[model samples]
Target: MVYHVLNGDALVSGFKATGLSGEIIVARECLIEGDLKGETLPEFLENRARFVEDEFNEARVHYYNNVVPEFEKLLNAEPGSEFNLWFGYDLFCRANMWFVLSLLSHLEGDKEVNVVYPSFRDKHDIWLEFGRATSEQLQEAFDNRINFAGRDFRLAEDLWTAYKQTDLGRLHDLSIFHSPCFPYLPEVCQAHIDRFPYKGKKGRPERVIEDILKKNGRDFKTVFREFSAREGIYGFGDDQVRKIYDKVMKERNP
Candidate 1:
């Protein structure tokens, strides 16, 4: 599995292998461990959380040193995977990406800072290339820090409103369900979904997937295809997507 820290807060987690099922779990483990400002509660969870956090930080450095640089090179070349787009479109991805970018940007031109900088500079450059200015702009808008709840609230609300206006959001819900990791995926996706009202109903986890698919003219494959096409420069292959999907399923079911 590979993980990319977007700004300084969130991590965009992915893998290189096909049908590898552990990225999401790893991501969740990292989140629980990092505690992002020590927000995670329950005193007993702290020890386990610290262990996870340590592991996540180690993996992150390892990925930056070895895997991420290579992936960045691929993204710079032609026929790259749409991984960047996948992250750009997803709320979680954007939040994570932006936070990481912001942090690195602040650390810019400073060799003394003890932070891992992505091999690919201007990590948010792809956002500009794709015309998804909101997230890119938001990254600039916020102080180069994670502050998920603080800065992410406005961004999340905006994305939820926009997604609710389109058929694609529903479709995403279906793809989430087909995965073996539906349990975990739904928890994350639904947290965002429930924040808004769609068709006079507050979105529920149990029915979100079916509800999305049932909506007229909603096509998950097509949206994914378009997303893939736009993000071709990022070199996110089918294998990576399948890996993330499988991993989420296992974690959810397990």
Candidate 2:
């Protein structure tokens, strides 16, 4: 039994097209950029569920009842079963990977877990790359999955635990420790830290958006499109971007 887990639903089809046999699970929730104060699974889920519903105005009952249970199945995989994680190198995927790796770290399970990342590309959005990949390419990627050693696990635990904390400084400090577990981690962690508002004023990304709008006189939609094109590495979707735009508008009008 090989369980292939991916970052989101975007690449599920590509994995399935590989004709791999076993269950496929999507992380469903975004742990990369949100409030993570809960100490337990239930508390964490509830916290994220409420945040998503309030921020995105979407319910999480289906996620809690359905998608979460699927993820939990990885915790109980058979002795010989392999748990393959397919993720990208962004903070978004890194956060979820950290959570999953952390969860597996505590469990005394016999299942073999491997990390399969987008090794083919050094700077492209791996999720989008997977979405556009052919079936043969997906299978090749699966065949080339990398197995983690002791140092990787130690680094993973460090990163995962640090990511769940309220102190972004811990993550910023971790940038100095270069490890093979996450080659892009140092830079990505810095990007995450940069996301916080400057002295509780405008966020760096939001300020950049406002500056673009001011100089070009473009509408919000155009500004957002331009931002995505230039700054997609921040892993922010239009909805999150829109909130910042709204904040800027309120600040300007208020």
- Give the winner by lDDT: 2
TM-score of each: 0.25, 0.87
> Candidate 2: lDDT over CA atoms?
0.74
Going through the candidates in the order shown, the clash numbers are 18, 0
Q: Each prediction's Cα lDDT score?
A: 0.33, 0.74
User: What TM-score, to 2 decimals, does candidate 2 have?
Assistant: 0.87
Q: Summarize candidate 1's per-residue lDDT along 81-136 as a digit string, tens digits.
A: 11121233233443343333332332222211111212122554433222323433
| Candidate 2 off by > 4 Å | 122-129, 199-201
